[model samples]
Target: MARAFCSSDDEVRRVQSALDEAQAGRARTLAAFAVTVGSDGAVAGLLGLNEREVRVARRTVGKDDAHRVAEALWERSRLDRQPAPQDGTPEPDSTAYPNEAPAQPGPTPHVAGQAGEPESSPAVDAVLTGAWHTGADLTTLAAELGLDPDFLAARAQQLAAEGRLTPTPAPDHTGRHRRMVEGPPPPADETTYLHWHQPAPQSPHHQHVSWEQQPPVTWGTPVTAPQHAWDGYLSHGQYSGTTS
Candidate 1:
């Protein structure tokens, strides 16, 4: 029994050694094919294995699965290297399998405000023109220009400072009265009065009246007729001594 177990172990080692040699040879072949065509990812996808598994299969020995992966990679490389159809049509055999032929990448689509392209120039011009002629604020102009309001406001301020654009004027608040805090009413004993003062003398020949020396004549104040002779001459229907 001991001799038989030893013989079985030796046979297993021999078979494993043979598999290691075959796997190493297949890995070398697959590596060459991978260099010629696509990367480990493409080859792994063709073999239905993940990238890590494919890499491990390439390195580790005694893996019959690696041989199968190697064969698939070799075939894929040959197909990729084949000449394109002369008539600009896809080769019939190339489309036999879904992923047999890699699709040619198309040009990327353009996005507004992309890094390389300058989209702000025309936008800034439109905003400035609208602001100057229409007197529209940054929020309204941003909506019209389809731009960010904050960005538009900042740009508008910069342009206005540079004298490239005129900023919209702030709304007038002159007549808009705000509510004032009410203070305590005036003292009850205090009397408020409206007074009418006498007009200055209009004639150059007459002496000028100095109003600063006279007290203001209130509503109930009395007036006496002038003693001068000119007072009768000056008394006309239009002239009234009483203050209205």
Candidate 2:
């Protein structure tokens, strides 16, 4: 039997052009899916192109690269439909390249305890309210509310779809990289001390008396004295009048 070839170069170019135009238009999700399907670097080997080139092609939607990818996908699909040879030779598997279709972008999936469900309660409403007022990101809000980020994101998307919440655009972090922060060392000349208060012991005579009937206790302020004052106190059993 004659081998079936893939689409012609002109046909692939026409399809790719259509896809590019659609991608630029409102069908952005479909365009992204088409380009990203079977995008696991292995497509480079199948198309006899380098991985970098394949990546560049996917990003820019280059005509040549698109044609090559489309041809590979078509061949893969054809191989999948073809049966084994009469001689009992196994057919080639086209799924060797990851061609998994992306999920259709539309209404969020129904989740337990999500909006519109019986499980939805005041807590959900409060979270949605806080999210509206603070404009916090999903991860931060999830952490603060002790909820899953994925669940929060999905719920937010659902609310946005329902016209109850406005979706905020993610911040652009292009060309921004994280760096380690080194704090300054502590001061060497400063002397620090910690003070703790000990509760007064109960007197034998007042052992039966409640705390409310006890006399008021006094607390003393800590002061730093000069070295001369300490020496005088140690020698005379009394502090000197001088203080620094």
Candidate 3:
């Protein structure tokens, strides 16, 4: 074997490859990052350039140094978009910071009935109300809030059942977002109605009860019918005799 003076380029590449693999496993996807920063164009825009100059990678596999550097910028943008505590929405995780989200990315996702039931909380209700009124994307909002989209969606259904929201919000085919809601669920009115028809009076010879026209009945309500008298006899279109 001949000895030759050579740099550690081969060893360096091997170690660098391992490092890249480890970081890639921990890092968020480019699409996820783009959502935080607005869009693929936005991630590149942070470099004082537009989409035409540098198109943000849609996937993570082929990302270059620019995408890696853009992570810090994307994280900051996400934080800036967080709902302020004073706004009544649940605050983002305090431990989350730029480029440090890998350790703690907001609160652990809640799947409504899985981790815990989706109880109606004031903070959640406020967020749902604002989203409905302002036409916000529920899935994106949930992500920003560090919540499981399904959990937030289940919460919306619970709110609707409790008469808080008018129409229930549903995810589209892709589950990327929820259908728009116009307003809080309309107030459900409770009503009680009584409907009955007295049978036509008959002469002493025949005794039979015939129901007259009854009032229109609404669905999902109780209807009552009274008893019919047997001894009553009709005379001149009126009951003429009374029974003891």
Candidate 4:
């Protein structure tokens, strides 16, 4: 009889398959253990344990080694047909728990448009005070702040609840207009002008803000007239060589 010899390639493939199966088993065991531990034993984010600590914990199981322990317990329970507890509550299934998320620290506060950092409470006040006078409506204010109007309104409502802002009185009993309260007084009078940018369009909602009306002013700031005064700039070709 000829002796049978296994090829090296076949042996290598067999070993690789075994390793793959083992990894899959370990993954399943870990999943089961995580769920079994429930919220109390589940730690948020990655375990900060060092390699040596992890090795020791793996050998001598601790609270953090719930998955491995759960796997062993499950195997014994299934093999022995262990009696269920009298209370009839099911033992936790570690497989159900998801990987914990990383912890987030508290918010970082700063002033907006200053040093390129978002403004904190005081900075928010300063920006708003300088932003609109004749009291800007919430939508206009939100546009100036580069935020969505609805988002700004929600924030405004929250602030109002906290006594930081006040909701404007209903325009009519029927509630036609919904405006936010005026922000804090500016450092100077509201009439004082800052550099006027190009006039915004005069839509029906914005008609009150017109060229004849002084540009909206912040408190403590004097309105400065533009150097070249023109009511409205006209195109050059539009007026070319036409008799007066």
- The TM-score values for the models, in the order shown, are 0.23, 0.20, 0.22, 0.19
11-90 per-residue lDDT for model 3 (tens digits): 67889999988766434454445545656676666655456423334454344544665677678889999867796876
lDDT of 2 by residue, 1-244 (tens): 1232334666788999998787554223322334656573666666566777556545665545555656766788899999767878666566664576555689977666646434445687667656554544445555687766545544555554566654344433332122112233243342332212333566866655664575433222223233223233334433233333
Off by over 4 Å in 2: 1-120, 166-244
- lDDT of all predictions: 0.53, 0.51, 0.50, 0.44
lDDT of 4 by residue, 178-197 (tens): 21133444454435443233
- Name the weakest run of 10 consecutive residues (lDDT summed) in model 2: 174-183
Q: Report how far residue 206 has shifted in candidate 4, in Å.
A: 99
Model 4 CA deviation exceeding 4 Å by range: 1-6, 39-75, 81-244
Model 1: worst 10 consecutive residues (lDDT sum): 221-230
> Residue 175 CA error for candidate 4 (Å)?
99
Candidate 3 pairs with clashing backbones = 165-185, 166-184, 166-185
